[model samples]
Target: MFKEQVLGLMDQAELQIEGKRKEIDRIVDRNQWKVIRAFQKHKVSDYHFAGSTGYGYNDRGREVLDLVYADIFGAETALVRPHFVSGTHTIGTALFGVLRPGDELLMITGRPYDTLHKVIGKPGDGLGSLQDFGIRYGEVALLDDGSPDYESIARCISSSTRVIGIQRSRGYSWRPSFTVAQIAEMVRFVKEIKPDVIVFVDNCYGEFTELTEPTEAGVDLMAGSLIKNPGGGLAATGGYIVGKAKYVELASYRLTAPGIGGEVGAMLGTTRSIYQGLFLAPHLVGQAVKGSVFAASVFERLGFVTHPRWDDPRTDLIQAIRFSGPEHLIAFVQGIQQAAAVDSHVVPEPWDMPGYEHPVIMAAGTFIQGGSLELSADAPIREPYIAYMQGGLTYSHCKMGVLTAIQNMIDRGLLHLEDN
Candidate 1:
């Protein structure tokens, strides 16, 4: 069973979203053309990923990327750049952005994303980890079996707190997800305890998970990527951080000039792709969510433990599955890819990379493991645990990916139809 305990509150949650949607509709109905014209002005950014802005110049592409990102995330200020390669990098930049010589960052989530352990702790690549950067750090914890312990967060709050980072969704954790309302509750809790502490959200796959963003939930800074939800499976690259204007100005400098200003320079052609993706995102996010639902049902029927069901959702559109071993993990990725691609153009394989505390393997057909259009499925390369994580652009695509994997099992006479 895909474990979700908040079902009792489903009715109330639905009502809240419906009201927000209606409000948004009313605003749209009143300014329909104005919205249309604003979107039309958004131009897609172009990149080759081969060189400096891919333009044969020492040009600054990140500045332009930010302008488009500000429009994308509904923030007072934003910055976008290819240099912010992964979701973690974007977060590291944001945290380092606001921390000063004497302040500290209190991480509300107990164990952060695995790879980030070093990035924030001492022994990491740079001179000082999150702690060494003049920002002392501490962690609020999770209860057993994975749930936020808000009281722990409150007890940890102190006068030296410069920033409080809240990871709103379940990433690689065994933890259950939180709704925007719950996220809002946490934000409010933090604010009541310390009004000036910056509330940052690692808003990875949770962009439209509920109906509103963390900005509406009172987050000071939020980060996500173009390769995920808001990118609409269209943007070729980038990450965005949006929030208060002054912090934004500081973060922008951290991203580029270290302590200078936000408008450092510009990317040659980033304006168009970011614009197009943001314009198309609302519809596309809906499509991806539908695929996620389908995936949850299909796998749940296979007797595998699924994190979410067709109707059960945690964060955004990710569909997570658990397999037994490394062999199964590799086999599963290969099976899904063999079934997903056009003539099976891309093959799935297992691999490991640096910076990750664990040995990670992924289905490579994906542009990026967590962000690709192909029906790519992946599980970590670990013993006794291989959690398959998959997402897609359309229902048909997701359906094919899972079905093909099932078909491969069937074709090998691995199982009989009568068994079902």
Candidate 2:
């Protein structure tokens, strides 16, 4: 009975997503070519191998990896480090390293990833945060149509505004992720207002989903987590900041300290894995994107509201589905957990996860802890009760996960396949 029902749903999802297969293939091939070109251009040789403990500053493999990433992303310099921690941490470093006291930082996008909220800080709220450092902050909410409010941005920009921050991914928001082209337009607009204003993109789950990166589109600097799209489901831990030489240098200084910028951090025997992960990132991202499309189609067919509908142009790996209420939301998340390769027997529930405003449920059963490159799903406990699902190393695994989620919903009576 399980096989029959799940297979039937899978068949439906396949048909629904068939129209996007060609587009997905085109993107995959183009990105794969980019990766190959980067490797060839950098002359990735055997000498670029990692040593045990990896304590020296002369790791050719680490240098080559940085070079390859910079070349691939069209940045003047790049810093890939295991020491920087999460995406939020990397972004924090970039912000703090560049902006000084009395300088202003403008966030044109709506509220960024939940974790960044604490970093931005509230007036008289967070200690040692941007606000606490005397770095002023301002934000302009997206218009109802989900587009940037240019007028609001214009009104908000101050002479003290030294940086314009853009988040490429939607984060936990319901808005659509911005495409490379969209980011390019934003760069142009911001530059017109203040030519020297630094434009930085928080490129978390948005890497490699398109042919070009935000840096290529005139972004001054960008940061992302190794556990997310760029890691290719292989890197154990790390983060990357790639862009203009000066900005990257400053971030490196903040990551380590003044004068030690970008020179001393060791790869700690993970250079080979990081290199291998980048090599595989393009294809792995494509597979994850395919899974997102499949998820959108399957859920939309089941009468749930979906962001970036299956046929919509995908700019990132996330696929969001709105549930009827908390029950349906919890069930869906538990469903994803049940589908995981690791901890399939463990049940997830909402809890006060630090750095977030509300309780959150996460289904992250990855071999590498918190690796978004592997299959996972998570959602904050809140209104509209939407779950943000992303990642699957293989399309087949993603497909199975969708089926498992559907089966779970069916079992819980939140969904009735027969009724559908």
Candidate 3:
């Protein structure tokens, strides 16, 4: 029944999509911009994080980052940063960028990313959560299936609330997130409560979820790693935050060393790579989604408690498989790596590392687990559920890697082979 509904929606949506597509039919007249062709040709640069390259300080690198930022977010922004470690660090900067001590913040969702629990004082990690800064933090629960609980969320907001934080994308979690309209609704709710409350979105896996961005609806600030979305899947490293000019100005100061102008003076890159990534993205993303559906369908048949979201996708890409134990976790990752490695076998073991204390074991088949189209898998050391993440810069690469991973397990009698 759900499949039928989805098919119906897609059928109807296609007509409208075509109408919209026709409006931009001239964006690729060959004479328009060379990027259109370059992207189609899959000539995007290899996404190498700046940190891997010893972090170049070239001034033009920053300019290239800014141009890419403007193109992706549709807002003239100063999206810049160098040392932003992971998603949580970027979120911390955005929260600090807008809400200071003595201010109140509504976490728009009740349970934010588990990593942020300490940052907002939920688990009593004194220095990490919101309590450390003297800022009052409020939580609103996600509905049973993980959509926004709008009314409860609205009640949490007060005049003391300076900003509302929204995680608009799916990271390594199974939560179904907010829709574009839902994000806009949160904006409307905050505006109704207090005209000045700003909305901040952790926009990973969401930049291309819709054709436009959160800014188009009413969001004030958005942040995500450069590698995940805007770096066109080729960025070596870094993250970005774009929105209202003033908020970006504040976040920029907190994000970069003094005098580095937003992304303007921080990022150096291949104009060809960023351009190509975005150009081929619409099609490449669609292909990636196709791969996810295939994974979900195949796994569900094997009876291993699959979560491919074949019928309903909460967000972009990143399919997950649930194994029951840590040993299984290691096995799952190892299987995927062996199946997809371009070279030697990549082994995964559960280990606890710095910053995040919970033991996280991972197999990084790509450059980084930030969706490098290279095969990779990671799981919490305690739980056997490993998230199999990969995206080929092109469809063929993604297809081969996924099938090989699945096949490796099946041949070993690990996964039921004929599931799909």
Candidate 4:
């Protein structure tokens, strides 16, 4: 049960965020229509939802799905498949697909998500990562304000620099997510320096948040997991890569084999959920964004720091709340788990999760394993503790989750309402 003060705080937060919620709704309206138009143009029907068999050769359903995704994202082509395991895997495929052993992959955004460190690999490690294959990696830290450091980026450019990577979301960081306008500027900036350099965006948690995606802003390639924003909470599993036909083609080769490419791979009965999920994505993403706004306002009012405060422009679903210590951080995350529709009885603890350097605590009790689109929270057990909360199939669910987390913290004396 929620304390009276907490309930009052949530009411105040909701009232304070009315205008912001309206703007999110408007964006959702635009995106929803865009999705409908794309689906209608491609004539999506029940037939397209049917499953496919071995090799999935000549799978019209799968082919049309790619067309639909390409149209929606404003890309030359798209490869939507259940084959891709996670967002990290999808992004790695796109990178490895296009980069040669001698080429350099530069990240303009400080560091990528934690899972990507291994994928970047250490030179001569022989673990078959990008560096293991002789593909060099470079990174330019964002400016103090979390904006791209153009001067640094320009200085980093070289003859071997083949790709400029931009992470649209602030993965595990306190920085603000980059907007489409910013992404467009980054694209122009990089291309101006090297006319032939490819601009790639890691678009996880950013899909459907804006009216236009990075691909439309001149990105050569972009990748995201289906269980995130674009999945609409229905897609059981998958990932998508969209961009220039050539780049997508190359990525497909890496996704499958050199010759097989996107031509094969059975649907395994995931076609319907994938299609329906895209159709519902715009509305669902709007709900999650609204929830993020509410969370920011509530936490800020409680005297804690929050990234991209309630009034800031949102480009992704992640809402970061800074806690004073590990106890407060862990309690907040476990509180979120207590609000889960599924597995609410299970308590979460910090563990050394694979692909991460620190012990990470996560509260992901959703229908789909690791589905961030369903109200979930996670944080690494380290200093300047911050919990990255994201996703909510509905705004009400997200609101309840936040309140539950607060109540949990209050019960443990980690948070006191009067401190505000």
Best by lDDT: 4
Task: Give TM-scores for every candidate, taking all chains together and pairing residue i with residue i.
Answer: 0.80, 0.97, 0.76, 0.99
lDDT at residue 88 of model 4 (Cα atoms): 93
Candidate 2 lDDT: 0.88
Pairs of residues clashing in candidate 4: none
> Which is better, 2 or 4, measured by TM-score?
4
lDDT digits (tens) for residues 1-420 of candidate 3:
123332333344334334333322332232123334423343333342232233444545344545555544666564655456666778788787777778987876665665776677743456755667688888776777767887787677776889888887544556655667878888887788788888888777665545557877888888876566445555556667788888887887767644653534423434445444555555545455555555565455445565545555435556777766655556656666665545336465666665444677665666545454334555665543656554545545544554555555555666553342
- The TM-score between candidate 3 and the true structure equals 0.76
Angstrom error of the Cα, residue 52, model 4: value is: 0.8
Task: Compose the digit string of candidate 2's lDDT tens values, residues 295-352.
Answer: 9988888888999899999999999999889988888888888888888999999999
The lDDT of model 3 is: 0.59
Alpha carbon lDDT of residue 58, candidate 2? 74
Residue-by-residue lDDT tens digits, candidate 1, 1-420 = 111322222333334344333443343343333324444455423442222433324443344445545554557777766556777788888888888867878878676777677767763347567766656778888888566688788888899988887886666665666677777888898899999889988887776545567776688898887787767676777777898788877777778776545544445455466555655665555555555555566555555677765555445656766665565556566667775444366665555666665666665455544574335555666655655555566656665665655555555555333454
Candidate 1 — number of clashing residue pairs? 12
Off by over 4 Å in 3: 1-68, 81-83, 121-130, 257-283, 324-329, 342-344, 368-374, 381-390, 418-420
Ranking by TM-score: 4, 2, 1, 3
